[model samples]
Target: MKLIGVLLFSACVVIATAVQQKDSELTAYKESFSPLNYLNRYKDAAAVRQYMGLVETGKMLSRDDIFSLFNPCHRQQMIALFETLYGATDFDTFFKTAVWARDRTNPRQFLYAFSVAILHREDCRGIKLPPQYEITPHVFLTTDVVRRAYQAKMTRTPTVIPMKFTGSVNNPEQRVAYFGEDIGLNSHHAHWHMDFPFWWKQDYGAVKDRKGELFFYMHHQAVARFDAERLSNDLPVVQPLEWDSPIVEGFAPGASYENGQEFPMRPDNMQFADLPFLTVQDMKLYEGRIRDAVSSGFVRTADGRLVSLNSTYGINCLGEVVESSTHSVNPVYYGQLHNDGHVLLSKVTDPKQRYGVPPGVMEHFETATRDPAFFRLHKHVDNLFKLHKDLLPPYDLSELEFPGVRVEAVKVLGTCKASTPNQLITYFDESHIDLGNAVDTSTYKEMVDIKAVVSRLNHEPFKYVITVNSKRSANAIVRIYLGPKYNWFGQKVSLDVSRWGFIELDRFPVKHTVITRNSDQSTVTIPEPKSYPEMMSEVQRAMRGEVEFTYDSHYRHCGLPHRLLLPKGKPEGMDFKLYVVITDFDKDVVSSDVTVDELNHISSLGYCGVLDGKIPDGRPMGFPFDRRIPNEEQFFTPNMKVLDLVIKNVRQKPME
Candidate 1:
């Protein structure tokens, strides 16, 4: 026993020493890994040149061939690089490859490629990525803030600065700018793209179950949520962008690149002209073909087979084709409608780049939503999916009915003692983000913290008390949704129009007569993101085996920010409707490998699909609601109920 104990102690000491050495090496490597290096401030040009020469000698794309991911060839080049990174045998090798790729890849492309690689690679799992805003503060924070942070770091005096919402009250569209320009909201968008990258292939070993359908549902939800915000701000719903007409709303993002380059602005009434490759006529052609496919109830595959659009996989197929992912049935005939639309809108101000200006915010996913045009563009995209859905057969009375269950009533209870029942509350809150990582302080020996506080819309915690009368003990899936009570014209919203405006609130399983659900436990959103320092500390502990870590938990950061789940309601209380539906749980097709306990943990299985697994819900993503309503009276079954309510913005002082 003594000999065994001695051997074990010596072995542990050796292993600990090796782990300490590797950890030290990683800390050093992170200095070069700083996303700010992409700005060229701390870039090593000789290292980049050497790396590019080696890659070119191997017959891969030259540096010039890969600049913007908007280009098809550039996207392909990035995929190749990502595959190389994923193929690494261990974490050490992956780290080395990432360091090499980081310096040579274009700054814009590096952001996507590196993030996607981190999400897909097993060795990189559980490793927390620094938030993109911290990586490129220039894009999220105003240039003035970034410049001041640098100035402060040089002077050895750090300070906290407050970041106000971008636009003024003059522009009516700017009413919801706070929602669109939110740091957490934009991070959610960027992170979702990383999970379901358009370039992903099945050969990569991880099949994104219903990748196409998920692509459709996620964006659809975003557009619907945006419409709800618009109605809250007393603005009309977003109008679809027209291909032939001039864009009326102008947008200046008030953001810049690290090289001191301001994002180009689009003037009011800017015309859409033909670029060298894509033209307005081409866009129209793509739209016409897509419409024809949906109308005919079939889409032609690449090999010339007509696939029916009426099957269980119909929506999924259409999603892939519309998003133009690698899973698209016919890329040549269908064309890249969604992607090219972004390209056309992005370059309207500087189509040729003859003025030597960067493209507008529309060009990148991270910064895209800051502009009003993004919602308009997605509204058009949603209509395409809606066209297909409009033709689907309405849910029969049998399918809609939950025979043994009836929802008697539903009410929301706020966390505050003075709060009223059935009334959800919203307010403005401020949170600080560390900008210490944004500034390159390699030359300085001492570490200094630079912080910025951002004001954003938030809501008080609330719970749902759902009264149910069940004839017998049985299981069912409960779904909750919220929407405006009136339309843009102040008329009572009809079922048809209100259908598109409803955003899903929560989805869960129930087996009793009474159900209580907390807002923090919502399935549609994850918890608010942790601070930069907090995330770093947690990741280090996970690496040292001090606590449990899983890829699913890591993915929690990719969902909608819990704080922004409810739109900013009127101070006097805005009228809204809450719709609850209970469906047979036996019919819900969840993967066998996923245990109920595993799912009980934080899961955004609705907005963001399960990583490396199937979506928990068996029904089409927006079941019962995905299709058009045949008759409003007949649509309300015993198992479903709608409650009238109001969401009030309880005014309070700034959080800071």
Candidate 2:
């Protein structure tokens, strides 16, 4: 009898193992990497062309003929495969150029520029590279080569800039200059959640500089007081609507309108006005719920038009009160940018002060470099907006808040070193793009050219300078620079220069001049900058709610889904309080997407007999029919009252 029992148990174990393996396919997909597989799959010439979004042109080329677009980590991973199947190119010139630009903050432009440089084979020695000089794609001889080159260009250190080499450093041919402008319109979707601590990963040639995701860990722990809460995957999480042990609180005046007697605004006005109290309350709850969802892992799409979500992503206001909107919250980034590469802004305010001049609002305040990235994943919201642009009502985004608006911005870069005060370029002109202007205008949603206020190189804030005149900026005041010239870790430097008329300066590029432009177009005017506010005077620790102000509408888009943080100058050991708030917009807007079927998924086979996780019960939103087996109570933190409430009010589960 004992032998038969043992045999039966062994049989059950094998069956359980097979079932578990099949269910664990997702992790396997992430690890599915192979050189042989790549070569074998691309052996067919037509297939290679298809992979690159190109048609077959009957070309014969070795696997090396193709280019790659991976990073150092990936390169290291596929070392054997790369060496065995690919030919090499001298990437020294490319590497030097990449670091130079990445040291700044125009990484996007750098990536764009790198693409142009290689395709045209241009000499990368001089500045003033014009936008017109063109090149030929025939140099590579086959679509596969061009496609391979493109991939290789992205992944390799010495990326191929947009310009082609014409045998001279003075002039280069522009190859595939529009490549960046032509790719997926939904690319913005991926920006919010691409992973974290990008300092080591950036390449390509750019003019501006940017900080990475790593800052939050040290910075928050220092400035924002809190117990160690491991980010849901070491990635920047989104901000929840209602404050609950938050790191920052966002506050701002809701949108003001020019009187709703107008037509388009009227539709929304009435919809908002007629909204039932309960309906509006539910909307607010949804907004907070969405915030929880996004911060936890939900992403937005580019055209998804999660318009309300944009409220959480950035600091902007739209409503009935109207006029001079300012932000109670601020974000940390390189700076702002014009629609085109026209201009760049930098940080200037003191760490304690609030950012955003009146009439503007706080937009997004988190990095997407995490396991579940909001930057990259959030594009679904935008994409949805784009796909159904017609069905949605039109609204003017023309005068909406721009991107890269820092609370205490100061320009510490340019030919004009520390000769001026820490000058912060505040106003914006417009945002332009390859498609046309920043706004669509077809609907009220017009995309404007909001430049990175404090970025210059590809993507960084390596060094900043302050100059006086818009042109021939030869002076500066304070000089500030991040990153270590000697080693890894953050550094801060303070300098003085009363005569330069500037506020601060960042480290880097002792050459090159800083030029300013005044729409006034009269003689260049002097800058009279405002001082950082008092509320930001001695920030120690504030709840996330205390720090930021938010506004929302019927659209689920308005919830606070971006993590908010205080731009602490010395985040090494500061402690600040944070708050999260939940409010109902006037109306409840139903999601255009299909209704979500409350899914109750389970993992693991019967090997362990029973499994882990909260076995929900009672069913309020229709779920958890008291199906407890084992390992239940692990999902919610004991500190979370909402889960406790849900378990008590919604489910029949007893409060722990």
| Highest TM-score model number | 1
Q: In model 1, where do residues sit more than 4 Å from their true spots? A: 1-67, 537-554, 590-595, 653-656
Q: For residue 641, give model 1's deviation from the true position in Å.
A: 1.2
lDDT of each: 0.75, 0.19
Worst 10 residues of 1 by lDDT: 12-21
Residue 522 alpha-carbon offset, candidate 2, angstroms: 24
- Kindly give the number of clashing pairs for every candidate: 0, 232
For candidate 1, report its TM-score: 0.88
The prediction achieving the highest lDDT against the true structure is 1
Q: 1-656, model 1: which lDDT tens digit per residue?
A: 33333332222222212220122223445454532233232223343344445465654444332245677766766766666566555555555556555545655565566667767766444445656676657678876778778877988887887776676788888889888899888888878878888777887787788888888888899998888888888888888898987787988777777556788778788888787789889989998999999999999999999999986569999999988888899999999899888888888987776787766788777888888888888888889999999898988898899888899988898887677898888998888888875576566646677898898889988899999988977777889999899988889966876887788999887767799999988888977766656655655565566755444334554788898889888888899999999987766646555444555653787788876666767788888888989689889999999998899887783232
- What lDDT does candidate 2 reach at residue 480? 24
- At residue 503, candidate 1 shows an lDDT of 89
Q: 1-656 in candidate 2: lDDT tens per residue? A: 33332222222222211111222212322344432234343223332223222112322122222111122222232222222211112333232222322222122222233323322222221111111101112211122323433344334322222322111232111111111111110121121111111221222122111111111111211111111111101212233222122223111111221111100100000111111112323433433433342343332322332333232112111100011111101111101111000000001111112442211111111111111112111222222222222222222222121122111222332122322222211111121111111111233232222211110001111122223222222211111211111101222212111111110111111222232322121111111111111112212112222432211111111111111111211112222111110111111112222111211111110000001112111111100111111232342121111100000001111112
